[model samples]
Target: MLIAMAGLPGTGKTAIAEAIGARLLRPVVSVDPIESAILRAGIDADQPTGLAAYLVAETLAEIVLGAGHGAIVDAVNAVDPAREQWVSLAARSGQTLKFIEVICSDVAVHRNRLEARQRNLPRLSEPTWHAVEQSLDEYAAWSGPSGAVERLTLDSVEPLDVLVERAVEFLGRPTSS
Candidate 1:
């Protein structure tokens, strides 16, 4: 299984992805760390590093899936191209693709979280509430071809465990430990 989690910043996508990966004992391939490294190395993260980060993550996902291990990808796959890259990689690797989109329904809470978020990566800059708000406005909802991928839309207000259970059901995997 290859679980690709997508959403805007401060949407709790990474938190959910981390929980799912830990529960399933699968490696989580996060694009943020790669992008951060590139920025720290004096590379602009705007376009060049974005491409590099995705390529690196795609390559790693392919290797992990080829090894018969499930992998989870945590990324801000806001656009079709970014989402398609992961889906295509999973298809080529012969792994089942599970697309999950996390969203925060509470605007105030979401904004607070975004403002309070700590930067774990030294080179990565945290976006201000204004930037996050602008991003929310610019975010394009996923509307890809049906049957090309299996998707699960989740609310950040839900408990992490419940969300994980829902994902397990969507994947047709047993919920039993």
Candidate 2:
């Protein structure tokens, strides 16, 4: 199985992803760290670092799945292309694809959380509230029928343990494939 975690920044996406990864004992390929590594390697911030990180993550996931193990991808898949790429990858790798879109519906809490976050991704600055808003503006709705693609939409207002429990149960179910 390949779990794709998606949401705007400060939506508690990474926390849930990490927790689910720990609970499921699956390796997580986080795009932020990959982006940080790329920047540290002298890739200019002006370059398409986000895209490069996604491509790198794709390869990592491919390799992990090829080894007959499930993997988790923590990223803000705000567009259809990004989502489609995961769908295609799942098909090619013969892995069950699961998308968990984490959201913080409380605006005040979301802003506070985003501002207070201290995720130490070297060379990768945390996104400002404005950037998160821009991401929301561009975020494509995870709608339409992507045949056999299982999805779980989660609100981060719930307790972390509860969220992880739900995610684990979701993933434990048999694949639609």
Predicted model with the maximum lDDT: 2
Model 2 / residue 7 / CA error / Å: 0.6
CA lDDT, candidate 2, residue 162: 92
Q: What is the lDDT of candidate 2?
A: 0.89
Tell me the tens digit of each residue's lDDT in model 1 across 1-177.
Answer: 888898878888888888888877989999988889889988865657877988899999889988989899988887888888987887688777878888899988788878888859877877787887777767776667423577789988888899989887777753222
Decoy 1 TM-score against native: 0.90
Error of 1 at 10 (Å): 0.7
Evaluate all candidate structures by whole-model CA lDDT and list the values in order: 0.82, 0.89
* Model 1, runs deviating above 4 Å: 45-47, 173-177
Q: Per-residue lDDT for 39-99 in model 2, tens only?
A: 9999999999999999999999999999999999999988888888899899899877889
